[model samples]
Target: MTEANSTPSVSLKLLVLVAILVVFAVVIVLLIFFLCLRGSRSWKRRKLAVKHSSGSIPLVSKEIMVVKTSDLTPATTSEIGDVEGDPKKEADVKVDIGAVTAGKSEVSGGGAHRSEVSVEDPNIGWGRWYSMSEVELATRGFAEGNVIGEGGYGVVYRGILQDGSVVAVKNLLNNKGQAEKEFKVEVEAIGKVRHKNLVRLVGYCAEGARRMLVYEYVDNGNLEQWLHGDVGPVSPLTWDIRMRIATGTAKGLAYLHEGLEPKVVHRDIKSSNILLDKNWNAKVSDFGLAKLLGSEKTHVTTRVMGTFGYVAPEYASSGMLNERSDVYSFGVLLMEIITGRSPIDYSRPPGEMNLVDWFKAMVASRRSEELVDPLIEIPPSPRSLKRVLLICLRCIDLDVVKRPKMGQIVHMLETDDFPFRSELRTVREKDPVSSHADVSIKVPYPPPKHAETVEKSRWR
Candidate 1:
């Protein structure tokens, strides 16, 4: 009985040993599998780090390609070197770029070959970026002979680009503080504006401490030269030409005030700012003092900056600025155009020293014909003369609310209707009692009741 019991105990001990060995084997297998998975993960992380640190990483999905030429062409994903993609797709990229460059040269009339292509900066809006060296070459090193105009702001030089395109370059006075601000304002204001009556901004150069603006070359001179310059006694500008200029200027101002999203107040509008092209079309230039007002705002409160005689009463006195201020300046310009008199001429007699005062006095006395410029070869008729005088008076109205908008002024100037109708009570419609049939007699209105009408009015 003792031998049988010992045999059963040995069998039980063997079974327990077998169970412990199986558990140990399972634990070792699990540990080995976990270590292998951790090693693979670590290797992958190191590989990614190596790629980034070595500067071999791929670019973002969206790639930018800039074209230096006048035209812009969209580039394919494979064209950008750093971007990751199918290796086979990039084989023809170099050939495609070459073709584009060649095509640009041909299209631009074979100027200096500029093959270097890179991404464009967003800060330079709407205009090409010109290097200082390029500007210097075009202006012939800013030679004195190249200067077409000089003013407090800067000097304007006529230039011809490598492409044989004529351009006017304005070299701004580098006062450091003020010039920088003016450059920013001018570029932001007129950079993208394209109108027949507005000078076009071709490009700009802001290199080192210098600031310059390139504009389309207007062959004919400015209005100031034609109006005030020595033209051998008899002025070349006929009455009709003067009217055309006035109409064009009004249209340009209308676009600025009503057509643009953020209306621009020219701040300085005078005869000097109106440029004439080859066809005698008016182009409004020099926006150095332009200010922008949002649609939500009625006016901008800012420093009173404008020509002394052209500045409006409200603006010059209280600094309340709006589109009406520009209208006031335009009125002064119209008077200048009409009388050929400086806005403030000390040379005139005491009472006639101020053109605005003299103009109002003359009209009040019904001597409006005396206000015409003597230099004009053919004088304006009584009706046309009175209409323009009324329009001018409306623009320069002391009450800003009574002043006509630029659009209304343009319509009034273009149309022959007397005392152009407006919301202002000053411009009253004809009395209903007066027979409408009298309008059939297209004859111009007779002279003022007190004064005897002259066959041909001679300006004093």
Candidate 2:
């Protein structure tokens, strides 16, 4: 009887120990479940907040291809090197970049999923700033081989984000005075302005001592290269393509002048600043010298800063920066597109050094055949030629008041005598140039009551 009692007591002890173990295990499991739920909630909240503030290019069922010039390309989402910066600018990304579109591109990153989007400053377009470490990785340690180009502002390197987003990082060297102000102003202004004819700013990284802007990588580069270079044309931008670019650029400028709340002036307008997309749609970039208009209805006073050759004659001679200043620069660009000549070539005789004067003199002298590009001796049509020349003249008007508003210029470009024929090619043989149609476009409203009555009577 004693042995049986002892055995029951030992069994009871074992049961108690087992119960305690089970309770401890249950507590641990519950803790883990709650922690996971909390972490997941935090992640979801961040994503939702970021998405609402910053809209991204929603994924569509479209295949992205890298427009390869040569087959060599970068690996997908390759690890970029580390960046030393304030904790905030550092990033650990895993994004899929889309295919390469630029002509000079050999490689591109797979497009990124929505998670790759930046949570800060959702307003920044195609450009974002990468920490020194991240950029180093994108450029493979800022290797000399990766440096694509440079300018007065800074150097540009081709980089691939972990998410496979291909971007061009403009590493600015000097951010002092106007240069620094321009950097910030451009970021603030262009970030808010979204239009097809404007280049997209992906994101930007402003790390310690390092400032950079990110832009959608343009493969073909600037227009000056393909149009005037000795290299046999790699891409033949058709006449229609040219017209579309002209129209698009004009629209962008018009947006700057009249579209804004108080209006802005693009002090500089030149061919080099015009960037083209895959479709040859021209985008106006580089508003480093742009001036914003205040409530003052008339032109404001300021120092002049623009490309010498493309600056408005009046603004260049006397710092009179205004909307008309931009109009004048547009004229110079228009002439270049028509004649493919440098704005001021000292090599030309004294009279010919000035492109506007040379071309206008030729046109007025009825030497129309001489102004046509040699490559297109027999251009597709004469109407196209005359219209271009006339528009160029109106743009270069000596008086600011005489210049056609961008809206009016766009109208003439859209006029019905489009896609000209061979016969319409006849040069302006009539003594009076029919360009008055373009000038008359500036009239804001219908003729006065008396004038309207006179017209009705004449019709009768």
Candidate 3:
């Protein structure tokens, strides 16, 4: 009887164990089922995103709200910075340092195009442009200290006013093809658009031989300065900062494409044209070659104008200009930021002359480690870096239609935790080698929306 009773107890324990095991199996199966369902939903959302991105004005998450720096209230205006240089002429300038407080004591009144037309001379009428003397004082003053930087465009200088305000003065020189057109384009286009990423056009001195655009002074300097090592040592630009700059530039470009009343296509998109704020935020500059594309029009019928390596393949082969052309250029910029090399030049690895061609092979083979800059070999995890590379693939797509919209591009960089992934750590390429702050803030534009949002071409 005792033996039989013991046997019964053992069987009862066994049955209980079996029941627990069965419950565990069912729970695991249910978990997997829900995971698969979640994955399917995500896939469907991505497909919908691609589908809805087909419109001229893409299906955006936020409604854009634009504010001119000149339009900032007096209380807000007290925060901008004053650039260095001459007094009398620079005083007329009102630089817009975007949202970052420039810390300048004063910014001039009226928007870039908001000023009233005036007639100063007896011979010329109200529409007549100013004379060289008045223009000189307005732009390049006789002072020797007014110079800022020089390039293919000519000399740039820092000009100050009697009021302690500062401005960047670009002295125009007649060098080559259609000088007047370049001048007119700056005056006309700067005459229209206004965005934080875009360099502010406080005033222009367009009187005869003295033509120059007075702009807001950028503290951190050009994107090329940091990316190309102009600021010394081949320091790796942290992946986060690079993504931030890329996102900012894309925002500015998107604004030109869809947000503006009459859409504008920045004919030129190069690293040299991108200017950085103190925080290393990239802003797209150099609108001299910008073309206005209207909603009703299919293409911009204009001259075949652009820098050599950065122009789009389609736009170069044919004169047809569109927003996608800028996308292609942005791809080149993306490649530069990734590899930390100039777009042009034959000094890369055996099969990699330009970044676009080389990046293609790497992305296809799933060998991201091969594509990153040599300076930053040990980069952040493959996931975060890979996401950046994937975005580059979209930006540099051979077919313009394949490229992601700038707004969508912004979403991917800002919202996605792509720069980080499972078991990923910092590598040289993705992390800054310098002692400076490797991390950066997201700095989202206030009231993120559709109307006034874009990637800033902040290289200028």
TM-score of each: 0.68, 0.63, 0.60
Which tens-of-lDDT digit does each residue in 92-196 have in candidate 2?
111112121122223236521111111234223334434444566677766777786766667778888767888777777654533344455455446457777
- Count of clashes, each model: 0, 33, 52
Report, for every candidate in turn, its global Cα lDDT versus the true structure.
Answer: 0.70, 0.59, 0.58
TM-score: model 3 vs. ground truth: 0.60
Task: Please identify model 3 stretches exceeding 4 Å from their true place.
Answer: 1-146, 230-236, 376-378, 417-460
lDDT of 1 by residue, 160-249 (tens): 987899999999886644555556566656777888999998876654445678999999999999999999889988899999999999
lDDT of prediction 2: 0.59
Query: Which prediction has the highest TM-score against the true structure?
Result: 1
The regions of model 2 sitting more than 4 angstroms off are 1-129, 175-178, 233-235, 418-460
Pairs of residues clashing in candidate 1: none
